[model samples]
Target: MYYAEGTHEPIIAPATFEQAKERLRKIAQQTANRKKPSRSAFSGLIRCGIICGDCGAFFGSKVWNSTSKYRRVIWRCNNKFKGEHKCETPHLYEETIKTRFVGAFNAILADKDSALENCRLMQSTLTDCSGLDAEIKSLLEEIDVVTELTKRCIAENSQTAQNQEEYAARYNGFVERYEKAKTRVEELHSIKNVRQAQADAIGAFMFEVQELDTLSEFDNKLWLTVIDTVTVHADGRMTFKFQGSTVIDA
Candidate 1:
């Protein structure tokens, strides 16, 4: 293969070309080592997150050699030939799987307008977190009040000689209230973080969509950023799940 510096405009940017070269180099290394099985081109391009929906096992890649012209790469359930009961999932060719992904992704792009609008609608509720902010503020105030009460109780116990049993009870009550309030605050913060993450994920999807008119070929960078999971089932079916929870099937 020859790569010459082109005078005409390049189809891919220089950085993208370098990234593709790196990916190819890594995948070449993976395929060279057959002693300990590594991933195939599909898994390498998409990362190691493919799942077998039938046996709930991870997928593995394999290469079959007949001749130089007839050599092929395929993927199958890792546990298919391991145990008494074999997984029923079918082996998939590398090109077929990649093509299916392109179809699934392009299907989403086909409805890009509606999908962006839907994301915006969902973001309206997820990003508008004034209610959660107010609740967090109220929780923080309660925590502060409980902390002050605990401090006051400890100070009283240290200053005045009181009944040991009564003083212990009062201090314990304040301590328990303070801990409960702190726990509540932590829970509320966790809820807020989840909402923020959802909003951010939707925003990212919208941003990527805005830059695309249509995809004529497979985009490695876009695939990595936009896809979350690719699942294959026993019934010769494939599903692509995007980052923002968009699912397409092949």
Candidate 2:
């Protein structure tokens, strides 16, 4: 009979010290293999992009002096570092921007009416493009009619029912007009899509704003995640606009 550790069985037989040690070592190895490392709460929430409004440049961060007394995380403008014009704004301290962004985000999130108003403003701005879509559709219809006329003129010319030179000139004019209308239609369509995307982006940003708890909870990653560009005015006013807003200033 054998007695296991911590068991209430009768100790009719006992293992040698070496045998007990071997059993404990095997148990330890099994436990180690089954255990998993703990994950960080914010492991997946990191932003790697920063856009500048003044110089239209992007900045990235790098950690420096990992073991030094002054361990630093630095953000430098890629343009200035590449011998581009000295950007007027200094290399921003990551902590400063992080603090400001959190505050701004919190303000937006706290006020339900304001967030909805921002969404409405974006929708209104995009509504201006609605007429352009209608215009493009009408132009497409005109092009179709002109194209049919050109085809009819070609057939009439082949049958010799119409003067060849006169039919050819008319067809060339119709082709030219059709091409111009088609180009205009394409341009308007592109503009319409752009406006629609902007509207959608604004709607999405509003939703994100509604989810945030407080300004201080905003992380550096959240700034890059939510904002398109941040403009600092001459009057010390900072405006942060998302992709869809006409103007978002703080």
Candidate 3:
């Protein structure tokens, strides 16, 4: 709660910081203002982000029979019938999506151990920040070297009479070097933070997937935690892409 703006170097680049804020904003949107009851579990949480392959629009749920005993809901591309070219991708029954997701997940279950191992491997590689640490250190040194040289150039210029054009050119060159080094350092920091975020996501995904011993029914929590998106194609092929880059087609 104290105040210290520039007391120390930032742990992440400004871009990465902005990315974190954007992620938080999306999560808030996904979670906030849910006073109205969600007819489908996937509706409010953005838990089921199914996309249309043809039109690249997210699927939205619609009630089939709001009044009858045999009421049901289906999901289709939001712009399926809006544009000049209608989306050939068919609308999906909610139950069908659930069944297919369960079956596709079971496919991963069939290769569970290997898939888990791969997730661990990727997480391990991502969490390895030593290489980035070394690069950052070297880059910091590069910046410091450039800074000292620029300082010396300015000192020499002030003490002696010299050609103004050459002086300006040399000074500009030092400024460019300093700028490039600083930019590269910030970029490396961003990359390092992005890898760290990916590692954390994979870890969370593995935890959620591993907790499920056997999944016979659709699980909302698991769906929210593990799935990145389900792409519904024109031929009725659905691809479930899970976190950690695991894909299963059904």
Candidate 4:
């Protein structure tokens, strides 16, 4: 095939295109070689993706028999009996977790439209950084002015015969103001980043929700994409934390 570049401009930048290709490659690998799910399914599924309500420890998976027909997967809190204060959280079977997920996920689907609306509103609110950007701009201007003033003060001090203490005081004052403005800019940036992350999560959740009205059976890829964590309590209470921080009890 001959090189056939599009007439229009490229849709994505080179770096972003490369990153997308890499991501797809990784996903392909994970799907192709699926086998015994890892015990520490941190970014995978409910093996270590669960949190214990009692001990606040992560859950780990175990196989009852390694080489037998009676092998069964069980999940329990890692610190269930580690210390004097033992965790009372009950061990859960893999099937139990899967069944619970189906129920909870179906519940979410029942309210899919309303949840999408709420998530859209939240994403809009969180992603709008106009106010913070304005403040950052103002602070940058102040920093620039202070920086120039400090330079002028130093220059004047060098050229003219000024009182040492007075000159030092003025120079330090400008420096302190500049530093304070810089620190405030950094703080604003930090806040913006955190909010933006939340917005992204909400957007992702909304997108996934929009794709399906109901799931006939559990799809591993979709489950991992939408679910963040599962928390189980001592009294057999379970909570599913979905992407975008949406929580549901099952």
Candidate 5:
């Protein structure tokens, strides 16, 4: 006969340490094999990872338990939930936004003409970098002229052929101006490359936008995948803006 450790209940004891360890391991394995509760069984489950249009914030949903049998999932702004700024919008039911997204997506995919037009609009805004080289050439010429003037002023002042104070001031001013202008030119070149990259991304998105066959099959994932943002105005009119696609209101 054996007693449980720190308990008055008597039990059969393992004859050796190895037997005790084996018994404990069996109990642990049984506990490990127990079935976990399924989380997805609830009807009104809240979906997380949704982005807010007004404050550019991400929001999550929580299930609120009540005396009633049914569970209610409330989607609240993450900022307001975290005691940040008080977002005025009421907590939206997950179904409301999901319905709106499905409807909007279906409407967009239904119109082939509109989709093609959107692609055209995006393609039109893409900048041509072919003329960038010529622009840079002109800017370099201007910098050279400014530099020559600054050098001449310095040389004349050193020879005592010009007023020292005025020549020095003028030379320094020109040098500063030339340097600023050259920096701006370099910035423009860099910007051109960035713009080209953005254009390529938009172009790829446009190609996909034009190929969509139907919108009814669109889900939340599809909406997040294609849409950049959806803006709801004060007048209750909401605009669904897509990535590299034009807005076509229904």
Candidate 6:
């Protein structure tokens, strides 16, 4: 079942693998939580959550034979034939997507405890902002030092007949230092905020996983709570990415 055991060259380099992951990450961030009401359980998720693997486009929902004896609800790439090139990926029926999702859910449920533990560990790691906090604190202290120097420079210039040009230069240098330190502190705080948001998402996913029992059907509520995105490959394979960035290929 293993692809390789280091006895041969890797199918893909680590850098390439990371680049693909980064692209997927950006797409997931843009599409996750785009909840739109529709007839399908994964309606809103169809055009956003379920993505085309070959062309990197969202799958739009389509309903055929609406007024006939047989009706078909399918999802296909939104940009299938929009450009000069066309996507070779096939469309997925709602029933098929649901069935695959159920299998993926059960597979994860089979390792529920391990998954929950890993999520908790990840949440803990992301929530810990000690390093960023320390850096921010140091920058704030530097800003305070620079502020005091600026005040001293101004006071000395006013108290005695000092060269205005030299005094202005010193004051401007202090101001520049203070501004840089303040800007760095703001950037660090922004980074901490993003980490905390990720931690919160992991915590929410963990809570949902802890509450669920055996999953026999596709639960819309649970799916929304756990699924961040889904990728449908050209070969009819589907990969479900749950909250906390845990992925299950089915």
What are the TM-scores, per candidate, against the unseen true structure? 0.70, 0.62, 0.77, 0.73, 0.54, 0.72
Q: Write the per-residue lDDT of candidate 1 for residues 1-250, one digit (tens) a residue.
A: 1111223587886435655675698678767744555445355554366788888787777778846777777788888898899888898887777788778877888899888888788788876768866876776676667667767877888999889899889878867776676676667656766776667667777788778777677766677667777888888899888767788898
Give the C-alpha lDDT of model 3. Answer: 0.81
Please write out the lDDT profile of model 5 over residues 74-182, one tens digit for every residue: 6655665456566554566656656666677667667757766766676566566557657766777777777777777766777877766777689779877787768
What C-alpha lDDT values do all the predictions have? Answer: 0.73, 0.60, 0.81, 0.78, 0.58, 0.78
Model 4, position 114: C-alpha lDDT score:
77
RMSD to true structure for each model, in Å:
13.7, 23.3, 4.8, 8.5, 22.8, 14.2
Cα distance off (Å), candidate 3, residue 188 = 1.8
In angstroms, the error of model 6 at 13 is 43
Candidate 3 per-residue lDDT, tens place, 31-68, comes to 67466667776675442478899988898888887999
Per-residue lDDT over 209-233 for candidate 6, one digit per residue giving the tens place of the 0 to 100 score: 7877667887776776788889988
Worst 10 residues of 2 by lDDT: 38-47
Which candidate number maximizes TM-score?
A: 3
Q: Per-residue lDDT tens digits of candidate 4, residues 90-167?
A: 999866777788788888889997777777777888888899989988888888788778878988998999999999
Ten residues in a row with the worst lDDT in model 3?
A: 1-10
In angstroms, the error of model 2 at 151 is 0.3
Best by the lDDT measure? 3
Task: List runs of model 4 lying over 4 Å from the truth.
Answer: 1-49, 63-72, 162-170
State how far residue 162 of model 1 sits from its true place (Å): 2.7
Model with the higher TM-score, candidate 3 or 5: 3
